[model samples]
Target chain A: MTTDVLIIGSGGAGLSAALSAKEQGADVIVACKSLPNNAQTCMAQGGINASFDINEIDTHISDTLRSSHGLGSEQMTRTMCENSAIAIEWLASIGVPFSLDEKDNLAKRFMGGASQKRTYYAQDYTGLKILHTLYDNCLKNGVIFKNERLLLNLIVQDKTVQGATFLDITTGEIEAIYAKSVVIATGGYSTVYHGFTTNGIGSTGDGIASIIRAGGVASDLEFVQFHPTALKKSSILVSEAARGEGGYLVNSEGERFVNELAPRDEVARAITREINNGKGVFLDLRHLRREKLTELLPQEMKLCRLHEGIDMATELIPIKPAAHYTMGGIEVNDSLETRDIKGCFAVGECSNAHVHGANRLGGNSLLEIIALGRMAGINASKFEPKTTAKNQEQLLKDKHFISGVYNFTNQINFYEKREFLGKILYHNAGVIRNEIGLKGVLAAVRQMQKEFTFMGISDKSKDNNTNLVEFIEFGNTLEVVEMLLVGALHRTESRGAHYREDFNSENETFRSHSMFWKEDGVLCASFEEAK
Target chain B: MIKIKRFDRKKEPNSVTMEYPITEGLNLLALFYKLKSTLDPSLSFTGVCRSGVCGSCSVMVNGKPTLACSYTPKSGDLIEPLDYHPVKRDLIVDKTKALHTLNQAQTWIHKTNNIPRDTQNLHRIERQSNCILCSSCFASCPVMAVNSDFLGPFALTRALRYTTDSLELQPLDTLTAIQQNGVWDCTLCGECTAVCPQGIDPKMDIMNMRSKSVQNGFDDPTLANMSFGFDFTQGF
Candidate 1:
């Protein structure tokens, strides 16, 4: 299939881009692994950051920069923050039923690290509403949706990325699709935690992996943001809305060590410290009014009761930090275009704008995604269709790589090895990192990579085989995880989400973003200043 | 022991049941993960957010529609794909036909007037907006047996959401569209309300839309044709 613009994922970023591109008279197609509106955007429960009448844009930018520990690009932050109100208006115009105040204005809330109540919300299920509205509008505008198609490879030749190859999950057919321009909005890699993450199963950094393998650069791959308040039992996210709605965190000693409204990195680190000290960390909503809690945070209430068997009115919910969002992905420039690959733009959690440099502020992700989506859409829609053919060698290589995962039979089990990968990465490269632990993660991942060559996939059936699909995601996770570890090891400084125990102080020499890319078929990492 | 009923069209048996040690958890998605990884590596299912929010992992447990990532499962609990839809593979039903009702019903807001200034009350539509589209309601609705063209619960609720919206101008167009196989076709068995994970009462939404349909010039087709009487088959 060919179109003017092909969006690889149908989350907030992809859908918004599709809509904007369609509005620009470009024929657009959105291809996703699963159904649309089922992506990671709905997991964001707190709200979207936008200042209408409450706060200044500069204040929002400062708060974001402070959260990123001064690594954020002020220009990009300015672009996002300046256009945030317009983003909110665009979402509202598309019929996102944002909760309104008594005076008939869009209601807002305070998420962690926000200076004011700037996060516009639709109760607690803010992201869900926005995502659904975007989807509703996209469908209304006749955005063609190709569901259940997994992106396999980007069609990159002559230094211009045109389209991609997709494996239809149902038919088991590998088809190459071409577009004038392709937008890789496939969200994040937080699912590397596998079972212990707040992300959807499909958040495997597929877009970033495909982009990097297509010779795109990955920026700040080290900074994985572990949310502070996932339920200890199931890792289902207990949103920051819980804390924003006056819930507080307490240790086993019944003491609040850190402010609940501090940035997520601080809260997560404090919780990890308490856990390391053998004190159980818990989120207490016992003091909040029952009616208020029920009205504002219905999802949190249900999650706590069903997942943890705790009623927020009576008992404290046990909490653990889980890998929630990846603050790093395929590095995109100010135009949201990849520096290395022309015509291949990235957006949302899958693209590192260097706006949320080291750590992301809570509500800013939703804001930045909309801005980036619009930017990419306007830029991609104006692109003239230039034909480019993939070299036979590259096509054959992808075919071989895809076919081998199904045909290879060995004693090594990918399932067990993946479980092991999650464990080591979480314990070592988790919230807290040190030289020894980072190196340990490196060594273990290397062994896992060696074993991956001989890994056995038990499922032989080709029809609707999630066994093969998940195996592909596992391979992508392995590739992205290596970049994360290498970037973490090379930084050698404590800043934002990348906390180094041995090098516990932030250093001026390593202020730039940790950029990773391939050099002659080998993975490489270095601190590179933004152009 | 836990047994998963797998369905593949290419396979001989049409459906096959495989057993593994019963693993208990807060939800069955984790149990399925343990089952798939350890016992039978070929077991197919889609589990995204185990938190019940994503609505991807809906299945039938013990012949009841349930979100596999949200509902707790026990030993000997029989799991299957959604009841009425064709199962693409094990526990993963093809939702294309079911999800198409949204588009068919034109559930989007169609504003006929340019009302620039606005006063809004989110409480009016907040409940309807919470739908996660797990298709559990569509799966459980007995009305689906008689009317495959029935707009289903989620689509009707969405129509009601727009009808009640202060910004929408063409509520009548929406209500009229949902009159046949849309709102009046529902049997109001409350199965949709029972299975909804988001606590969205599509049954109630359908009931409310029925009143609005009458409030406008639209009538329940069964009643419009008949002289007078309540039609249990064609909802109140």
Candidate 2:
């Protein structure tokens, strides 16, 4: 089917972009692997950050820049700063209710990096409200949604983009969707870690793999944000809003760990240090007003109350640093257009515009989606679809070249290997790293890569093979890990989320963004100085 | 071992079966599918995203409202529909209203010029924006059981989300809508919060809204008119 724009995700970015593109007179189709709401965006617990009356745009902007460690673009930062208030207003027009302050204005609350209250939210299920609202609006506007179609590959023609091919899980049919422009908003790839702040099932980074395989370079693959507190066992995120509302981090010994109000990186590092030192970390809500705690996060508190038999309002909730947001992805320019791919763009977690840089602030990630999703959608509408007649020849050659990946007679248990890879990445390239561990990780990746060459899939069909698909994704993850190790090895500085214990000093040279990619299977790194 | 039986109110009358001797790894969803094949083919229920992100398969398991997709079934467990809503059939109940009511309450942020050309600012309440609309909050809400117009915790939570976004410009209208029949309706009983499988706190959004509303001179007249408004509802 021919579409004006094919959005390859149903999360906030894909849905928002599809809606905007449809409004711009485009035939938009939001292709989702699961139901519209089943994406990881719906599992988010914190509120969106936008400038409301309680704070100026500068406060939010400065907070974001500060969180990014001087790596965020000034123009992009300013643009987002100026547009946040109006975005909230537009959402309100769509029936997103804002909790009020004493003046009947939107209630603004303070979070991690922001200097003043700017975050607006519904009670806690803000993501749900936004998803449902957009989904309903999309239905009303006649936007087509192809749900449960697992995207397998993008059919690129020449230097221009064409469309995507996907496997319909219900019927196991390989359906082709041709589009003028494609948007990759498939979210982050946090499942590369053993236990993550992300819902593991949705961490495949499918959109990203498709883009990268189409000659799009994924940059800054090393920077991953680790949330300071996740439920110890389940790794379910305990929202930053918890600490924003006076929750504190404590040690197993019941001592306050770090500045309860520090940036996410600082708090996460502090807790990680404690865990490394044999003192398990816990998030203490004991001193906070139980009524207020229960009121702000009723479900989280209830989980502690019912499942753990500990009232989070009165007790300390055990926690640890969990692998969270990815700060890298398919490289895109200022307009969210993928470099070298004229008709392709990326948004949300899958795009590395470097807005979040080294680490992202708590409320800002949501803001980025609304801001970037709209921009990418609006900008991509101006693009003219290119005929990929010649590009088809190149695609055929590339396919022939990579056919060996599927033709190997050997096989490794990808699921088991994935688990091992996750454990190694978490232990070596996790919150704290050193040259020795990174090198160790590269060695491990090589060993896994060697083993993966023998990995065989049970299904040989081109139409549908989940095991094969997973194997391919696992390969992408392994390929990406080499860059992470290289980035970590080159930084040699302790700053933001990338802390190298061996070179523990906060060096100015390492303040820049570590841009990494692969050429001829060799990992390379370049430092882009922070603006 | 004790065996428990559950019937589908929609498929067939008295289509009950022994659900125990259930495999150790059996969940509520597995039990339902078993009944579908063994008891009646016409048996229908709701489920999507069996991994628990979708809250469509919520049922009363062991006398507690739980998501059938995630909850493991037990011997002698009593499985039924949520307490407040009328059962549509067997375990499925009317979920269409909860999400619609949330939409009616303007549970999302309305923007104007702040429509971000980039996604950076849209992330302010981005995580909270990930609600699956499972209606577990409605099933768990104490106020919604007696007063249908309470707006409940989920709707109120969604309403408050806009107030929390950094991009929202018109806080007044959103807050006003939230304060009216939305924030003021929640009893702060914590039932909705407790039952939320996603760990979202709709009750807290209500409390935040109440505080914000009081700050805005929108007092809960229901609380104020306790001597008068209490006359309408006899159960309270």
Highest TM-score, which number? 1
- TM-scores of chain A, one for each prediction: 0.95, 0.90
Candidate 1 pairs with clashing backbones: none
Q: Tens digits of per-residue lDDT for model 2 on B42-105?
A: 3445554344655667877666678876666666777666766655444546554565565566
Candidate 1 lDDT by residue in tens digits, A1-531: 678899999999998899889989999999999999788888777789986543588799889888887779889888889889989887887678888777677778767777777988887678899899888888788999999998888988877887898888888777777888889999999988876788777888999889888888998989898989888877888877688778889999899989988777888989999988999999999888788888877767877877788899889889999998889999888889887888989999999988888888888988977877888888889877566554455556667777887777758888888888887888889999988998998988877777786885788877788888888888888889999999999989988889988898899888888888887878877887643
Model 1 residue B193 distance off true place after TM-score fit, in angstroms: 1.9
What value does the lDDT take at residue A286 in candidate 2? Answer: 73
Q: What are the DockQ scores of the candidates, in order?
A: 0.57, 0.10
lDDT of 2 at A327: 82
Residue A467 in candidate 2, Cα distance off native in Å: 5.2
